[model samples]
Target: MIDALYVAETGLQAGQKHIDTISNNMANLNTTAYKKGRIEFRDLVVGREVTSLDETGKRDLVSIGNGTQISRVWKEFQSGDLKATENPLDLAIRGGGFFEVLLENGEVAYTRNGAMKVDEDGYLGTLTGYRFSDMIQIPPDAKELEISQDGTVTAYFDNDSLEIGQIQLAGFMNAQGLDSIGQGIYVANDESGNAIYSDAGENGIGILQQGYLESSNVDLVKELVELVTAQRGYQACSHVIRAADEIMQITNDLRG
Candidate 1:
């Protein structure tokens, strides 16, 4: 009975984590370029022992499983739907890649959110003020700003077109291994490999789409189903715990 209680406790903890992950995915359903989270579970085996010898004199091994635990929680990197905003500054990647941004701490960060804006210094940056790593700057008097599929920036002034700096993208060997630091930003780690900088639409990188933004990749229906499953699992574990306690109480009353 004591072992049953412990096992059910583990189940409750794992089920709660699963539900939390599902809730987080649903909460970010409307976020720009948001990736959904996936939870993995592993069976917890407490011990293994030889129970007895078979008729052929072979040992029979019995493995005891305590419960289940959360093995990992990884982000799904599938591309989301592209939404057209009709704003030239809004950009979206059509394939695999991430936008490179220069943080205030002089470190490079990666993101899929492409809602960009011009800073006070005419430098192109995210709405939250993270400057583009390429340092592409727009002229103060420029008009008709346009970014081509190849990430070539251009503007017209005095009926003449001027070329701005090109926007570059970064790729990773294991993008799922990147560490997410919120705000749709990620940082490279050892498991993620180093950032591979490339020109847009080159070297397997994605092409940039001006006047568009990437929507969050969360699927509402899938999350709702997962939430239901997790809730049932939690309830089942609670029942197991309750049953173990009641049986223990009955035994104690009979002894008295």
Candidate 2:
């Protein structure tokens, strides 16, 4: 009964984590370029002491799986739906690549959010104000801005156009290993490897689509179904714990 109680407690914990991940995904369904999170679980095993002696007086070690635990929470890198905003500054990636941005602390971060804004200094940046690290600046008095599929930036003024700067996309050996730093920014970790710079449409990188933005990849129906499963699993674990407690109570009553 004690072991059952402990196992049920672990189950409850795992179920709670699962539900939390699902809730986060659902909440970010409308977030621009938002990637969904997933929780992985592993079984916890308990083993007998190696020095323990069996009935035959010989040392024996036995292993038994006790319960489950959350192994990891990973992000899904699948592309989201591309939405047409008709805004000239809006951009969408048609393949795999992340936009490079410079953080306040001068650290580099990556994102898939392409909703951009031009600052007073003619600096191009994300809607949240993270400027492009590559110094892609727009010129003042430019009547129009154009971003080519290859990420070349062109400014048009008085029926004349000039190439200013180019936006470079960064690719990773393992994009899933990137750490989410909130606000659609991700920093590369050891597991994610180093960021590989490439032209937007070159070297397996994705092309940029002007006047579009990428939508969150979260699937509402799938998340709702998973939410139901997590809730049921939690309830079942609770029932197990209650049953174990009742068994102990019954034993005490019988002794009395």
Per-residue lDDT of candidate 2, residues 1-256 (tens digit): 9999999999999999999999999999999999999999999998776777889998887788798999989999999989999999999999999999999999999999999999778799998889999787787789999999999999999979999999999999999999998998999999999999999889989999999999999999999999999999999999999999999999999999
lDDT of 2: 0.94
TM values, all candidates: 0.93, 0.95
The positional error of residue 166 in candidate 2, measured at the CA in angstroms, is 0.6
User: What local lDDT does model 1 show for residue 53?
Assistant: 82
TM-score of 2: 0.95
TM-score leader:
2
Measured with C-alpha atoms, the lDDT of residue 27 in candidate 1 is 94
lDDT of 2 at 162: 96
- Runs in model 1 lying further than 4 Å from the true structure: 48-62
Residue 78 of model 2 has an lDDT of 95
Instruction: Give each model's whole-structure lDDT.
Output: 0.93, 0.94
* Cα error of candidate 2 at position 42, Å: 0.5
Q: Which prediction has the highest lDDT against the true structure?
A: 2
